[model samples]
Target: MPTALSSTDEPTPYAAPGRVAAARRAVGDVAILFQFRRHAVRRRHLARVLSLVFCAITLGAAAVPALCPGAGESVGTHAFDIRLLLPSAWAGILVLNMASAIASGGGRELISREEAAPYPVSPTTDHLGALVLAPLNIAWMVQAWILLGSVSYSMPGNRVVGSEILTLLWLVFSTSAAQVVAWAVEAVRRGAHGIAITRTLLVCLGAGAGAIQVSGNATHLLDQVPTRWFIVGAIDGWTWRWAASVAVLAVATVVAVALGAVPTHLAARRLPRDEARMETDQHAPRPMPRSVLGILIRTDRASVWRSVPMRRGVLVLAVGPGLVALAGDLKWSQMTILPGLVASGGALLFGVNAWCLDGRGALWRENLPAPATALFDARMLVLGEFLAVASLITVVVGGLRAGLPTSYQLAALLCTILVVTVQVVGGALRWSLAHPYPVNLRSARATPAPPAAMVGYSARLATSTTFTSLLFSGCAHVPDWRLPVIVALPCLLWSGLRLAGTRQRWQDPVTRARVVATVAA
Candidate 1:
């Protein structure tokens, strides 16, 4: 039996609160630095070097147009003025940033929640880490380059310097604001009936935007956009108004960053009901497949569909860019690029680490008495089918807005779909075999590879796909339909050769054992 405590021996009531506060303060304050250190330690030297090199190249590309004389003057044709395009470009970038932030259910993480579970990683830390990692995305980087290029090429020579500064500030402000909104959205999404509420809100927003476009109010809206002030301020040069605008944006960015943490904290406190439900739900067994290949394909298909990230990514890849294309009413020449972009995004979902979908079960999978080639074939088939379906959806949606195509245009578009799907499949399989990382796809925020490696992979894929699409885009202009067919043959042959090589490697017993061991571990 314990005796009642005397006044002098009473327990401190504030002890638990004090400890919690201290842990929160300690981790959130240095979270970015800690994450950076961990990443640096884990990442390979070659990947680090490649990422740095890519950043340098991207910066140089963005800067060149501004530095070159007459670049801005050369942009406008007699039919279209550069100034008229500025507001739209600015608006597009902001929309892209917001869409990206919202789609990831806030933003992608530098360190996943599971990894941070051992530490008292505060919500503020999680938010900041997401912000830091946002720029790693290929789409984000491409849009940034476009925004900078547009600003550099549209502004007058003397005004270019001021406009560039203004544009960069706007980028910061927009990204911060988007993050704040994303956090709020995530907070709401974790509440009761949140998924339905959020889905309804998104649908409403999309419908309203579509209505605005359909009713011919888009131009009127564009004219009244706040981005116009940035242009006006920059063009006027060295004025109090310009200085004030810059100051306001800086303050707003600070405010947005701070405000984002509030919602992040709230959201973190609640359970992720949707993800939890998904992970816990039971599934009825399907009828048995007749053959080994059929069973393997069915298993792979289920894996792709069941994973949160894969499902979300596939939906976004299928729909997001297509909506953009539809709104713009892009021509066949321009539409040829969509398939490549869609395919690249699809491959990034899980194709790059195709074998890792099996996770620790890879060893069990390898021991099954089936032909090794059958396993490889199943994965490839599933991946290719996944990509092809997404690419087809994008094309169909965009084609609704695109005018009827000429023979040459039609051939180019059809061939583009085939060539890009094959190209991505071959490349993805090769990378999956050569460099596989074990990643759990159960988390909505999980990446198929390490962030640093993902950067490298995305860069290579973007470069190759963009070039291939451009080639096809150019081919769409030729009068003869046969030109596309002729061009596609070489690309198909190259991709086939690569796939064959990957298959050969997969058949080898030693290499197969090593991959199985690594992924399983």
Candidate 2:
């Protein structure tokens, strides 16, 4: 029997009110997500964690004197040791990085990207609705306040705490200044060159500080240098050294900001679609050159050299070693490991972002004429270049002054270095591939990548550290062998991030309450 007009066959139960409500809910959900991010990025819990961390450090520092502080009056009084040798080596490495950047015309020159004429689009008018207007600004202010609070916590007359705060201030200048320079350079000069200029300037600042000591010593203007492989040595706090150093940094910051703000031809002629939003225009690297390596891989190396993200990634890993090594005073041998560590660390970090950076294009490549191996090889080559530069500057100069260990010892050390680095890179790659990081930035400063990215990186790092520690138990040469427990530890960090991101990508929208914008007027 024919049923009376079925509701399914006729118009379904749809209403305008429900549709409108759904739309509102979608927008609300987005707003809620943004609020959560604001809190996460601000690291509401970070202050507490940092307070505890610093307290532990301070207590340990205080105990040194009461417990078993070195009786030596000054670093110079001590014979050549790791402390003295490490910094000297780091200084050398920095000088080399600066020289390479300057000579290459910047990191851009080292790694090239396509360029084109700029569209007549104005950034100010393009974004009509909600956007991240001042992420960097918010972050910067939070960091400033954090620094102020941390320094305030140290006991009165604690020169170490004061010096630490000042160094952090310099970093603030560096990041801010870089933003200004990059903006101005892109505005006026345009093209990849503008980016290169900023990279070179930063590299110079980092390298120059270390090179100064070497130069002074070479010229006999200074009798000795300061170094400790992994720590910043005690500053004189007694006189104008801190003020002078601060003044120099301040001047540099001012100059960079002034130069950066001025508009340039570059602003009018940035790389066409390539420099625009990357997600909008993804392209395959041009054909491979028919050369020695190219003959084997059937690809052009230069075309695949993506320096910006990868190089910057490398720099992130390098930063820890770079800062730690930038100490004063040292012996002959301690410097060697620092450079190796820097180079390998950077490469591993880059690997995490590699597959993701490849995107669909990379996947296609993996499926086609070039395999993942090819891409990996080319990327590794790039890593090698960075390592050579880092290690050459770090190891050679530092090693020479710090003194090299016996050949076998050096080999073991080098092996350890490579292994650690590989472990780090592998872990980062696994993390990045499983999860991902936020690439879009309103400012030039490479703020913390997505929290997921960091979490992944940390997980991998921990795993890697443990594995390498255990595998090379004898080579690690640390005081204790128990540190390797991290290697075999089971974890689902990358899985968690991937799951969260996927859920966020697919979840239904919701309506939410609003909050006031928290940024400077």
Supply the TM-score for candidate 1: 0.91
TM-scores for all predictions:
0.91, 0.45
Error of model 1, residue 35, in angstroms: 5.0
Which pairs of residues have clashing backbones in candidate 1?
Answer: none
CA lDDT, every model vs. true structure: 0.82, 0.40
RMSD of each: 4.1, 15.4
Q: Relative to the unseen true structure, what is the C-alpha lDDT of residue 134 in candidate 1, on a scale of 0 to 100?
A: 77
Candidate 1 regions with alpha-carbon error over 4 angstroms: 1-44, 72-80
Candidate 1 overall lDDT versus native:
0.82
RMSD of 1: 4.1
Model 2 steric clash total: 33
